[model samples]
Target: MQELEEILRAHAARYPAMEAADYVKLIYQNEFGGCPAAARDGEKERAVPPAGGPLCEPIGGGLCRVHLAALPQGAGPALDRLALATAREAAGSRERFLQKLELLRGLCAAGQLPLDSAALEAFLAQGGAAGPCPPHSGAYQAAYAPGYRVLRQSYADMLPAFLEAERVAARGGVLALDGRCASGKSTLAELIGRVYGCPVFHLDDYFLPPELRTPERFAQPGGNVHYERFEQEILRPFTGGGEVVFRAFDCHAMAMRPPVTVPTAPFAVAEGCYALHPSLRGYYAGAVFLTHTPEKQRQRLMARSPKMLERFEKEWIPLEERYFSACGVEQFCGVTVDTTDLF
Candidate 1:
C-alpha cells in the first residue's frame, strides 16, 4: 500500500507545470481514491486501480509492474497534471477522508512538502475546505520536470484487460481483443504491445479482397473477414510458436499487400472486429470484448472518419451487431469491457 503511495507521489512530482494547490488536491485524491483492499477489510469484489502509474503490465493475480524507462513522451505534462488532479473525486465519507488525512500526514513528512503540519490538519478536520490547494505549498514539481502522460486517464479502466493479458501470457497462448468498430480495439492493442512487448495482429490487416467479397460470402455471419487466410497465414504458424509472415489486405488498393513478419513473444494479441469469429476464437487462451455507448461510438467514428460515418451507421455497425449476436461474441469472451468513458 505504501509502495503504491510512493509511486503516486513520484508520478505527481514529474509534472512541473501543475499549480501547487492542484498538486495537493491531486495527491489527496490519489491517496483516498485507491486505498488498498487490505485497508477495506479484504474486500474482494472491488478492483484495485493501477497504482504504479498508467503503463504498468499485469504480472499475474491482479499484480502489475511499471517499467519506468519504457514510459513514452510528448503527451505533455499539463495533461498528466490535470489528470492526476481530477482523476478521482473527494473521499465519499468521513471515515475515508480521515484515512486520507493520515496518508497526507505521512506524505508531507516523507516528501518534505511545505504544508504546515498543524494548520493543514486543522483545515482538513473542518471538512477539508482548503480551496483545492495546501497552504505554504512548495515548488517541488521541477524535481522531476517535463513529465509525460501515458494513458493515465484510462489506466484504471484498462485494468481488467491487462490482468487478462497476464493470464494469457502465463499460459503462452494468444489473447484476442474484439470490439465495436470505434470502441478502441486498436488503441488497446497498441498499449498492450507497449507494456507486454507482444506481437499484435489486427483483423483489419486480413480484410477480404475484392474477389472474396461475393454476395454469398456477405450473406454469412462473420464472413466479411478473411478468416480462412488469417488462419492459414497467421494463427496456424503462431500456434507452433514461430515467426508469423502474412500478407495484409490493402483496402484502398483492393488487393493483398506484401507480406510482413511479426516475431513471436510470450503472448500475441489479436485485435479488431471479427477477431473472435467462431473459426478463429478457439485459438485464443483469453478474450476481451470492448464496447461503448452508441453515442460515444458515433462521436469517435465521426472524429476518426467523418465521410465514413453514414456507411458505419447504416452498414458496418449492423453487420457487426449481427455477427456479435449470431456468434455470441460477448458471452463467449471471459471479459466484457465497457470503454464508453475511457475514450
Candidate 2:
C-alpha cells in the first residue's frame, strides 16, 4: 500500500544506507501478525491483513501473509518454487519459511520472476494443490550460494585484520571483535586466535550453572544471562593481570565443567556472542563490528541451520535490536567490516 511504503521510506531515511530488505523485515515484524509458516494441511489458515489501517487480505496463513504483500510483481512461480523447496528441506509438518524467503529473494535477484502479491498467492495455491513436495535444485543451490561466498570471504578478508591485531597484541595491545549472533563473531575470533597464537575464551563458559539457569530472569523480555559470579570469577581475574581457571558452561548439565587453569597469556582473545558488553569496552585496545545486511544474515542462518532461522527471526532478532539500541556500540566501533563487500 502507498501508506506502508511512505512509512517505510520515512523510517529508512532516518537510518542512512538502510536497504529495502531491512525495511521489509521491519514492516513484516511490526505491521504484520508474526508467525511461522502455516501447516501444509491448511490447519493454520487465517485472514491476515496489513496493520496500522484497513487493507485487503492479500493472502491467508502465516508465511503467505507477510511475504505476499512484500514481494514485487510477477514473481508468483518463483515464489511457489521457493515454497516447495522450503517444505521439502524442512522435515515433519513444520516449515522453514525463512529459507523459502531466501530462495524467493535469489529468484528475484536473478531476474527469474518479478515480485508481487498475486505471484506469491498463486504460488502458495499451486503448492497447496500439489500436496507434499520435494526440494527444488535451483532453489537450494541459489539460496545457499551467496551465503557460502559470504562465509568464505569473511574468513579470507579477516586474515589481514587478524594478523594486524596479533602484531598489536605482541606489542601489548588487545583486540576485541564484537557482533550479534551469527554475525561471524566466533569465526573471526577463532581466526584471530590462530593468527596471534593466543588463547581464546568464549563467554558462554561463564554463564551461571545450569540449576541456576532458571527461566525467571532469562524468560523475561530483554532478559540476558548476566551472572555476577561470572564477572568476578572469570572476567575480573583475567583482565586484572591474574591467572584464572576457565570452566566451560554445560547447558545440558546446567553446571560448570571441571576447571582448567588458563595461564595469563599476553594477547588473550576473549570472544563470545556478547563480547562487546559495555562493561568490557574499556579493556580493549581496538574493536571491530562485523556488520551484515539483514537479508544476508537471514540467508546465511538458513543455509547453516534451517531450524535456527525461525528462532533468529522471531525471538533473537528483536532482542538483538534492543541490545544494539541500548548499547549504541555502532557509533563507537573503531573498525567496521561490511560483510557484503567480502561476499
Candidate 3:
C-alpha cells in the first residue's frame, strides 16, 4: 500500500491531467506487468463470475465485464469532477491521496462499498469516477392537470402495464418514472411498492453526507446533486440483484445510519432523480415517468421545500433542462404516465 501511494503521488506530480485509463496503465505496469494485456490474461484466468449470473463480456479492455451491470445516470458534472480528482490522485504528489486510493481499491475488491449516493460522492471526492457516457432522455411531455382526479386516474391506468412489465422481467426491461422535483416520485414509488408488494428504494438515500453537501452546488449554473455516488451504491446494487441493504438519509441527524438488509423480493421499485440512467435501460423490467409543467413542478417544489427553491430555480432547474431533458421519461420509458391526466 505504501509503495502504491508513492507511485500515485509521483505520477500526479508529473502528470496532473493524466487520464484514468493512463493511470491504470501506470499502476498495472508498476505493480503487475508492463502492459494491460498481460494483466488481463492473468486476471481473467482467475476471474470468478458474480453469484447472480455470468459476467458480461466487455467491448473494450478498459471496462470490466462485471461492471456492465452497473449503470450511470445523467450526473455528468459530478462524475467528471470525481474522475478528475481520481486522476489527480492516481498521478498526485500527495501521499494521503494515494493511501485513499489504496483503501478504495480494497473496498471495491471486498465488495463492501455500498453503492449509494453518499458513497458515489465520496468516490468522486476521493478521485474515482465512472466512464464518460451521454445521458438518455424520453420523448413527450404532459401538461399539468388542474386537480388530483386526473393524476389519480392516470396512475390507475398506467399501473397495470408498469406492474406487469416488472413482474415479467423479460429481456431488456426498464421502468422510468421521470418528473421534476415534488412530482411525487416517492409517493408513486410507495404506491408501486404496495401494489407490487416490493421494496422501494429512494435515490435521495444515496446523496452525499450532510457535511459534504454544498449550497454552492446549487449556485453553479448547471450543477445537480452529485450523483456518481448514488449510481455506484444504490442504483448498481438494485439493478444487479446483488445483496442490497436499505439505508435512509436521516435529515434530522444529517448522517447515514447503518443500512437494514432489504429483502430481494420478486419485484422492487427504485425512485429518485435520474432513475432511468442510460446504462440501466435494459436491466429494469418496467418504467414509470411522472409528468407536469415547469410551473406545476416549481409550485410543488416551493410547497415542499421552500429553502431549496432558490437552488432548484437557479441550479437544479437549468441543470435538469440541460442534462436530464434529453433523457426524458418517454424516450427511455415504455409506459409514460401523465400525472395530470390521471388526477
Candidate 4:
C-alpha cells in the first residue's frame, strides 16, 4: 500500500497530460464510458449468444434485440454523473422523463456533443416509449424513453461511492478517501476532481522520511507515515486557508524533494491508505473507506505485478490487513465502499 500510493502520485505529477489512448483506457474504466452490452429491457429477458455481446464476448446477460437497439449511444457520458441522484426517485413515466431531462441538461452543461432539445422535449412529452426510440427523435434515440442506465462493468461502476463526497464538496467540505490498496480510490478521486473541478491531495506525498522509517515505528499501526508533518504542512494549513506547501518525499532517493504548493480550492480531497488515521480523522469533513474482497484485490494487483504475487502474499497483504484492523479505521469512516460487487 505504501509503495503503491507513492507511485500513483509520482506518476500523476510526472505525466500530467494523458494521450488519446490514455483517455480511452481511463474513460472506459468507468461504467458510462464503456460499451452498453450489459443493458437489457425489463419486459424481455431473452438470452444472447456470447459472440453477439457488446464487445463481442458473453457479456449481455439477456438483452432483446429491440431493447438493445433502444439503448442510447453517447448518452452514456452524460448520465455518468446523474444516475445515482436519480436512483432513489420514484420510477415511472415521470421519473423516466426527468432522468432524460437530466441527461440532456448534463450534456448541455458539459458543452459536449449536440442534443436536439426540441425533438427531445417532444419525445419526452409523450411519456417514454418502450423498445427502440420512436422515429424523429434525432441522434439520441434510446435516450428519449430511458430505463435503468447500463453500467460498463468497470471500476467507474462505483461512481456511487464518490457521489457522497461530491455532495459534501458542494457544501465546501473536505473529503478524505482511505481504502485498501488497489481498490480504485485514486481512480475515483481523479474522476471526482474532473467532474467537480476540484483539486486533490494525495497522502502518499507525505511518506515517511528515511529517518522516520525505523523498525520501532513500523511496529505501530500506520506509524510509517509522517502525519505530524502532513498536519502542519497540508491538512491544517490548507483547510485554514494558510500558506499551504509541502515536499513530496522521494522514496527511491530516501529524501524529501522540492516544495509543492497546495492550490486553493472550494473542496480539497485527500486520498490514499491511512488517510483517515485516528489522530487526523477530525481534520476531514468526510472520510470514505473503500473495501474489496481479497480475491479481487489480488487480481487487481496481479494485473499490474504478474511477478509480485509472492511478494504481495507474504508482505503487502498482511501489512494492509494489520493497519486496517489495528487502527480501527473501518469504524471511523463515513462510508465503506465495497468494490467487489461492482461487476
Candidate 5:
C-alpha cells in the first residue's frame, strides 16, 4: 500500500484522468501479466468449450484471474490476500496450497500490490458495500448503475461527414443531429463537439411549456417542441452569426429558466428530437439522422427513464412517428447512422 501511494504521488501527473483502480491494474499487470503473452491471441480462443459449459463474453477491457472474482474493485488490483481467502479453501492439499502461494509470491515479487490496494481503497471510498461470495459465482451488473459504465464506440462512420461539415462551417453553421429517442444522439453530439471543436445545443432545452401542451397543438406533427421560440433564440442566432442568449425551459418547474449567453464558435451541433424539423431545416449546414430498433429504443428508455415510458408510448412516440414520416426527416438528413453500429 505504501509503495502504491508512493507511485501515485510520484506519477500522479502522468495519470491525471486515471482513477485509483486503474493504477492498481498497472501494478498487477506488471507483476503477473495474468493472461500470458502466448495465451492472449489464439491458443485459448481455439480451445473449444466443454459441452454444456457456460460461456461469458466480458465487455470493456479484459480482467485478470484475480479480477475474475468480479470484485467491485473493478480492474484495479488482484491481491494474494484476496486470493488466499478466495482460493485457499479450494486447494485440495498442502502441495496445491503451496503452489498457489508460490504463484502469488512470484507475481508480487515486484510491486503489483500497488494495483491491488489502490483499487480496494477506491472501491471502499466510492461507498461500494463490499461482501463475500463463493468463488465462480457470477459477477452481477447490478453491483453498479449503468451510468457508471462507460459507453465506447467508434466515430469512423460519422467522422467523415462531421469533419466535412466542420470544414464547411468554419465561420459558423448548424449541424443537426436528429435521432430516435434514447438512441444516444446527445452523447454522440457531445463527442462530435469534442473532436470538431464546436458547441452543442440540446433542443430538449426548449421543450413546450405546459400551457402549449393543448390537444390541438399535440395533434400537429412535431408540435411538442416550442420550435418558434427555439428558432428565434437559438437556431436563428447561431446559424446567422448573431449575438445569442437563450433560456432552457425547466420541465420540472414548468417554467423558463434564466438565459445563458453563448459565445461565438466555428460550428454548433444541434442535437435532439425534431432538431431537423421542416421549419428549422434551412438553418442547418448538414444533418445526421440516427436510427434504432423499437425494441432497443424501448429497452434504453426503460433503463434510462422508466417513468417516461407511459407518456412516450401514449403520446411522444406517435407524435415523433408522424413528424418523421410527414417531414421525411430520415431522408432529409445528409447522413444516416444506426445506433447498433456504435457501442
Candidate 6:
C-alpha cells in the first residue's frame, strides 16, 4: 500500500485543508465505494463526504464522476429527485476509474506523485478486486461514527441554489426559481428542497385555463400564468404560515383538479417559468434564475415531441422572454445560473 500512501501524500499537498479523518473517509470511499441512495428519476446515486476545503473543493461543474449516496432510501420525492439528478450528473464508475488512472499518470508526469503506475494497471488487469469491506473496515467505521452515510453532493451546478436555499431557510423564507423553459429550474428547485428539507411549489400547477386566454391577457407580459390564484392561494397562505390549499390547473384536461393542501414549512420553493414575475418576485427572500444558450436550450427541447418544440419555439419561449426582459427577472433575482454546459 505504499502507492496508496503516496497518493494520499500528494492529495494532501494539493489540498492541505483536508483533515486526516476526511482522508480516511476518502480512502474508504475509494476502496469500498459510497453508500447507496435512490432518486425519484430511478437513478442509483452514491453519497461521499465533503473531502477538501476551498483550495481543493470537490463541488461544482466538471467531467468528474461523483455522487450523493447518503440520502436515505425513502427521503421523500424532493430528495429523491435530487438523488436522481446527482446520479445523472455523475460519470459512470468505469469513467471514474479511467479518470483516476489519467489523474495518476498526470501527477506522475508532473513529478508530483511517486508510484508504480504500471503495477497499479497490472493489478487491475489481473482482475484484482477491492472489497466487501474486510474485518478492519469496522475500525474506520467506529472512528467515524454513524457510519459512512452522510448527505453531501458535489455537483458544480448545484452550488448557487444550495447556498441560496440555506440563506432563505435561515430566515424561514421562500425562494423562487425562474428561468427559460428546459433550463432546469424544476430540477434545481428539487435539489434545493432536498438539501434544505423544504417544500416545493411549482408554477406549472397554477397554469392558466382556456377561459382566461383572452387577447388582452395574452398581450400583458407575465399574464400567461394564473398569478391571481397564486397570489390568493399559495402566496397569501404561504406568507401567513397557514396551510396552502389550491387546485392545480390541468393543462391536458383544461380544467382545475381537486384542491391540494400543502403544509407550510420553515422554507419553501416556487419554481418554473414566470415564477419571478414582477407581481410575485417581491415576496421571495431569494431567487435563482436559470438560463442556457439558445443552442443548448433547443438541444434540451429535443426530448419533447416535435410539435411541442414548435410551440415552444413559436409561442411560449417568446412569451417567457418578453416577461423576463420586461421585468428584469435575472436582475431581480439574487442568483443566476447559466446551465449551458452543466448537466
Pick out the ten consecutive residues of candidate 5 with the lowest summed lDDT: 144-153
Indicate the worst ten consecutive residues by lDDT in candidate 1.
37-46
**lDDT (10s digit) by residue, model 4, range 1-343:** 2332232233224333422222122112121222223222221223222222232111121111122233334333334443332222213243443343464445434543233345434544555432232222221222223133433233235444555665676577578888888887898788667656777878888788877778898887888678888788888887887657888888788888999876777688888888877778888888888889989988888897889888878876677688899988888886788878653
Off by over 4 Å in 3: 1-174, 209-228, 238-240, 249-254, 326-329, 341-343
How large an RMSD does model 3 have?
A: 24.6
lDDT of 1 by residue, 1-343 (tens): 4644554455445433434343444444343432222111111222232334444533222233233333323222322322332223223454554465566677666755544566556656664534332322244323222122222334445756876776787678899999898898999898777656788998999888888889999989899999999989888889888888998988998877888988766689999899999998778899999999999999999999999999999999999999999999999999888988866
Candidate 4 similarity to native, TM-score? 0.58
| Candidate 5 accuracy as TM-score | 0.55
Q: List model 5 lDDT by residue over 258-298, tens digit each.
A: 98998877678889998987899998888888888888888
| Number of backbone-clashing residue pairs for each candidate, in the order shown | 1, 7, 43, 0, 1, 7
Candidate 2, residues 1-343: lDDT per residue as tens digits?
3444344444434333333333333333222222125212121123222234222211212122222333334333333333333333323222333444444445445544334444444554555213332222233223321110001222235533544464447566456666666677777787666545677777666665555556785653324545455456656777777886767777778766898887776667666645666766677666777778888888888888998789989977776667666777666666677765444
| Per-residue alpha-carbon lDDT of candidate 3 for residues 1-343, written as tens digits (9 for 90 to 100) | 5555455555444334433333443443333222222212212222233334323321111221221122223222222222222222222233443455465456445544322334434545654433221111111001111000001222233443444444443342224455556666777776555444566667666555655567775443223444555555655676676666656666678777787786445556667776665655555667766667777787778888899999999966776665456655456665555555333
Q: What TM-score does candidate 6 get on C-alpha atoms?
A: 0.65
| Cα lDDT of model 6 by residue, 1-343, tens digit | 3454464665556544443233433443343233234332222233333344221223212212222333334333433343344544444364444454455555545655443556445544644324211221233333322212212333344655665666677688789999999889888877676556678888999888888999999899999999988878887789888888989989999888999888877779988999887888667899988999999999889875665898899999999999999988889888888988776
User: Per lDDT, what order, best first?
Assistant: 1, 6, 5, 4, 2, 3
Which candidate achieves the best lDDT against the true structure? 1
Q: Model 6 Cα displacement at 81 (Å)?
A: 17
lDDT of 1: 0.65
lDDT at 304, model 1? 93
**Each prediction's Cα lDDT score?**
0.65, 0.50, 0.46, 0.56, 0.56, 0.63
Question: In model 2, where do residues sit more than 4 Å from their true spots?
Answer: 1-156, 163-173, 208-223, 227-230, 341-343
Superposition error at 175 for model 1 (Å): 0.5
List runs of model 5 lying over 4 Å from the truth: 1-152, 157-171
Cα lDDT, model 3, residue 206:
58
Off by over 4 Å in 6: 1-25, 30-154
Stronger candidate by TM-score (1 vs 4): 1
* Clash count (model 6, backbone only): 7
lDDT at residue 294 of model 4 (Cα atoms) = 87
Provide the TM-score for each candidate, comma-separated.
Answer: 0.61, 0.49, 0.45, 0.58, 0.55, 0.65
